[model samples]
Target chain A: MSNNPIGNVWIYIEQDGGAIAPVSLELVCKARELARELKVRTEGVVLGSEIPESLIATLHAYGCDHVFVADDAALKLFSPVPYQKVIVGLAEAHRPNIFLFGATVVGRSLAPRVASRLQAGLTADCTALRIDEFEDKASKRVLKNKLMQIRPAFGGNIIATIVNSWQDPQMVTVREGVMALAEPEEGRKGTVTPVPVALAPEDTAVTIVERFKQPSEVNLKGAQIIVSGGYGVGSKENFRLVYELAETLGAAVGASRAAVDAGWIDHDHQVGQTGVTVRPRCYIACGISGSVQHRAGMSESAKIIAINSDANAPIFSIADYGIVGDLNVVLPKMIRAYRARV
Target chain B: MSLSILVFAKQVPDTANITGQAMKEDGTVNRAALPAIFNPEDLNALELALELRERYGGKVAVCTMGPPAAANILRRALYMGADETILLTDRRFAGADTLATSYALACAARKYGSCDLILCGRQAIDGDTAQVGPQLAEKLDLPQITYVESVEWVRKGRIRAKAQIDGGYEIIEAPTPILLTVLASSNAPRPVGAKRLMQYKKAVTRSELSARHGGRDYEDANLLAAEEEGLRARGLWIYEWGVDDLEADARHFGLAGSPTKVKQIESVVLTGSGTKDVPPTDEGIRDLVHELIEDHILS
Candidate 1:
C-alpha cells in the first residue's frame, strides 16, 4: 500500500437562513457510503455566519467523522465570490479525494467554479456511485481502487459511467432524496475544525441588494404527502383541483414537466429531471402519464398513488396504488369524502 | 467598433426517441436510422448570437465538435450569417463526457482567439448535462452568465444579461470576453436568409474533399497543381486541427484524463396495477372518487 493516507470524503453542508437544507443530509449519507467503500473518513464542511454547536453535533450524528466549521459574517448570505474563495482555500490546504455536493441552486453555481479552480473533474447530478475493482487484460494486474460515478446520460436514456483519471479529487453533485438519510446517532462525538475566513469587501463582486424568500406553503422535497398534476389536467385553471386536493390533505403540490411546460403550474413545482427531484412518502400523481423524464426524478418515492383517466398510463406501472378516472370529476368528490373522514 | 462573437454548437445523437433497431446491440446509436438535425436549443443560442452580430455590426463564427458530417449545421450557420465556421473533429474526442468535451472546446475557442463574446445553449437535448458551458467558463477563467433569457445590454467593454431563476429573474452585468448560456425562451432563431444560402451552398468541409480524392493522384505535376488550385478557388477547404495543433496537455485531453467512471447499468421498468373506469355520471364519479379518497389516491 502507498504510504500516503487516503483522503477523506467531504460533504459541503448547505444551510440557508439558519436552517439546514434537506439535501445537505442527503449528501452526508452519500458521502458516508463512499467513505465506507474507500475505507476513508467522512467530513462535513459547514460555512455560515455563526452556526450553532447543536447543528455541528447534528452533522456528526448524520455520519460525519469531523465537521469543518467556517463561521464568518460574510457567509450569512451566499455571495459566490467569497464562498468560492473560502471553499477553494479549504480544499487546497486539506485535499480530499472526493467532494460530494448537493445540486441545489447555490451548489450549481459554486461547484463549477470550484472544480475549475482546482482543475478537477466534476460529474453533476449523479444518481449513484460505487467502488469498482477490475483486472486489466493487458497489464495482467488488478485495478482495485476506482470511483465509479453513475448518472443518467442522453436525457436519462442510458446510464453513463464516468471516470476521472487525471484529477486528484473527483467530485459529484447529488440531487436531493437520491440517497437514504442515515438515522441520527445521538451522543455521537466528532471534532470541530474551525477555519478562519478573511473575506475582504473587495472579494464580493456581486451584492444582494434584496432577498425575497417565497412564502413557505409546503416544501415539496420535505413534504410527507404530495398531490401532483400533469398534462391531462388540460388547462391552467383546472390546476386548482390539484391544489384543492393537496390543501385538503395538507400536502405539497407537485407537477410533471409536461404540466409545468404547458404553463399550468410553476417550474418549482415541476418534478422531473430538469426540475426538482422528489421522493415523497405518499405521492398522488393525478393525470400524469409517467414518461422516462418524469420517472427519472421521482421513481424512488416510497409509495406512489397514480390517478388518470387512461387505465394504460405508464404512471400506474410504478405506482403502489392506482386509480383510473378523470381527475376533474374524481377530485371534488374525493375532497368531500376526505373532509367527512377527518 | 465591430464586435466578434463565437457560438459553440454540437451535433449529438437523437437519443430521445430510440426504438426498433435504432440502437444496435452493442449500445451504439445507428446514425443512419436516426434523423440528423440541429439541436433545438443550440439553434436558439445560435440565433441569439447572430442577432447580436447583426445588431452590433460584428462577425459571428459557429464552431462545432463532431464528425465530418456535422458540417451540415456549419453550412446552415453560414447561410444564417456566421462569417466563418470551424469544425473540431478528431477520433480522440470520442467517448468524451462533459469535462473532456469542454476541454476540447476550450482549446478550439483559444484557436479562434480574441473574441468579444461566446455563446452556448443552456444544455444539450441529448446529454441535458448543463455542465459544459460553466465548465468551459471555468477552463477559460471568464465570467459566465447561465440560463440567460435576454441580453438586456451589450456595449464595448460590458454586457448586462437577464437570467431566469426559480421565482424571478436576476440581471447580471459582466465584462466583455464573457460566456453566456442562452435559454430556449430567450428568442426565436431567425430562418436562413435566401441570398446567403445561395452564396454559401458550395461550401465543403475538409473531410469531404479528402473523401473525393479517393487515394489517387493526378499523373502530371501540372494536373496535380491544377486540382489544388481548383479546390482553393471553390472555398471548400476547412481548417482541421488535431490534438497537437491546439497544444493541449495530453494528460487532460481524453477519456484517460477524466476521473469519473460508470460501474453498471440496470434497466428499471416499474410495474404496478390498479384500475377504475367509472361512468361519466355524477353518482358514478362520486363512488369512484370516494374509493380514491379512501385508498389515499386522491387526497
Candidate 2:
C-alpha cells in the first residue's frame, strides 16, 4: 500500500461581489459526502475581493470544516491568469486530497489550469460524484480513496465513470443545479484561514473591458419551471407562444437544437447534448420531437410534460404527462386559463 | 505586424451513431463502431483562425495528435485555408488522457518554433473534458481566455476578445502569445474552397504514404523519400512527427503518463414509472395545469 495519507477535500467557492454562487454551495454539500467517505475534513477555498465574514459563517453552516479566504482586489473579476496562479500557490502550500468546482465558465477555465500546473487529473462537467473502492483486474490490488466521477460522454449517449487514482488531488467541475443542496445548520462553526495571495504584475494579462448581462438570456438552472419549444415550433414568430406561456407560469423559456439551428431562438436557450442541462421541477416540451440528445438534458427534472402533434414522439416515453395536440391551439388556451386564474 | 497562430484540433468518433459495442469489456471506448469526424467545436475554432488570418495577414498552422488517419483533419484545415499543417502521430501516444496529451502537444508546439497566439476548441465531444487548451497554456506558460465567442480586435501586441460566462458576456483584453479556446457559437465555419480542395485532396503525411507502400520495411525507401520531397516541393506535404522526432520521453507518453482510467461505462436510458395521457381538449389542458400545481410541479 502507498504510504501517502489523503488530505482535506477542497471546494472552490466562486463568488461575485462577496455573495457566494449557489453552485459553489452545492459543491460544498457534495464535498461533505466525499469527506465522509475519505475520513477527511471539507474546506472551502474563497478567492475574491473583500469576502464577508458572514459569508464564511454561511459556508461553515453548509458543511465546510474550514474556509480558506484569499481576499484581493486583483481577484475581483475572474481572470484566468491571477486566479489560477493564486489557486495553484495555495494548493502547493496546503495539499488537498480532492478539489471540486462548479462547471461555470470561470470554473471550467480555472480547474484545468490548476490541474495542469499541479500535474493532476481533472474531470469536467460531471453530473454525479462519489467515493468508491475498486480492485484491479491484473494486479489484484485494491485501490482506495477513488472519486468516481460520472458524466455523460460520446454526445450524452453513454455515461462514463472516470477515476484519478494516481493523482494527488482528484479534481472535478460539476454542472450547476445537478447536485442536491445540503441544509445549512445556522449555528455550525468552522475555522477561517486567510491566505495571502501573491500576484505578479505580469499575471494580470487579461483585463476586463466590459461586462453585462443580456435580458434575453435564460437562467434555466434556477428556473423551477421551463417552457421549451422544438422544431415543431415551425418559425421564429411562432416561438412567442413559448415565451407567453412561460411568462404566465413565471418560468424560463428553453429550446431544442432544431429551433435554435433554425434561428427560432438564441443558442443560449438551447437545451440538449450540446447545450445546457436542466433539472427543474417541471420541463414543458412544446412541439418537440425529443431526440436522445435533447432528453439527456431534461430527463432529470422532477416532472416532465411533453406536448406534440404526433403521439409517437420519443419525449412521451420519459414525460410524466404526455399531451397529443398542436401546440399552437393548446398553448393559447392554457395561457389564457392560467392568466385568468391569476 | 501580422500574427502567427497555431490551432489545435481533434478528430473524434461521432457519438451520434453510438450503438452495438460502444464500450469494450475493459471499460475503454470501442472506436471501431463509431465513425470519426472532426470535432464540431474545433471547426468553429478553425473558422476563427481563418478569419484572423484574412483580416490580420497571418499564417494559421493546424496540428492534431493521433494515428495516421488523423491527417484527414489537417487536409480539411488546408482546404479551409490553413497555411501549414502538421500531424503528430506515434504509437506510443495512444491511451493518453488530457495531462499527457497537453504535454505532447506542448512539445510539438515548441518544435514548431513560436506563435503569437494559440487557438483550440473548448472541448472535444468524445472526452468532453475541456481541459486541453487550458492545460496546454499552462505548459507553455501562456495566459488563456476560454469560452471565447469572438475577437473584438487585435493590434500592437494585444487582443480584445468577447467571451461567454454563465449569466452573460465579458469582453477581455489580453496580450499576444496568449491562448484562446473558442466556443461553438463563435461563428459558422465556411465550407471548403473548391480550388483549394482540388489542390490538397491528395495531401498525405509521409507515414501515410509509407503505410500505402507495403510497411515500414519498404525496399524502396530512397524512392519513397524522393517522392516525399516532390510532394513537399509542390506544397502538398503534411509534416508528420513521432515520439523520436519530438524527443519526448517514452515514460511521459501514452498510458504510462495518463493518470485517469475509465472504470466502467453504462448505456443510460431515461425511464419513468409511466406517463399519464392527457387529452388534447381545452378542459384537459386546464386539468393538467391544476394537477401540476397541486403536485408542486409548477408554482
Best by DockQ: 2
Cα RMSD (Å) per model? 4.5, 3.7
Candidate that would win on TM-score = 2
User: Would you list the C-alpha lDDT of every candidate in the order shown?
Assistant: 0.75, 0.85
Window of ten residues with lowest summed lDDT in model 1 chain A = A207-216
Candidate 2 residue pairs that clash: none
Interface RMSD of each: 4.5, 3.8
Tens-place lDDT per residue, model 1, A1-342, is: 112376788889988766777878978888888888888888889888878888988899988999888898888876556777899998888888788888776677678778867877788777777877644443455666666777766533356666555446778887766777879899888878998989766565444444445544547888878889998898999999999988998889999877876668877788876667887777888898876668877888877877789877778778766667788877886677677766
Cα error, residue B87 of model 2, in Å, equals 1.5
Fraction of native A-B contacts kept, per candidate: 0.31, 0.81
lDDT of 2 by residue, A227-322 (tens): 999988889999999999999899999999778867788877888655677988889999987765687678888989999998867789898899
Pick out the ten consecutive residues of candidate 1 chain B with the lowest summed lDDT.
Answer: B268-277
Native interface contacts retained, candidate 1: 0.31
lDDT of 1 by residue, B232-272 (tens): 57554455666777869866666654544454554444455
RMSD of 2: 3.7
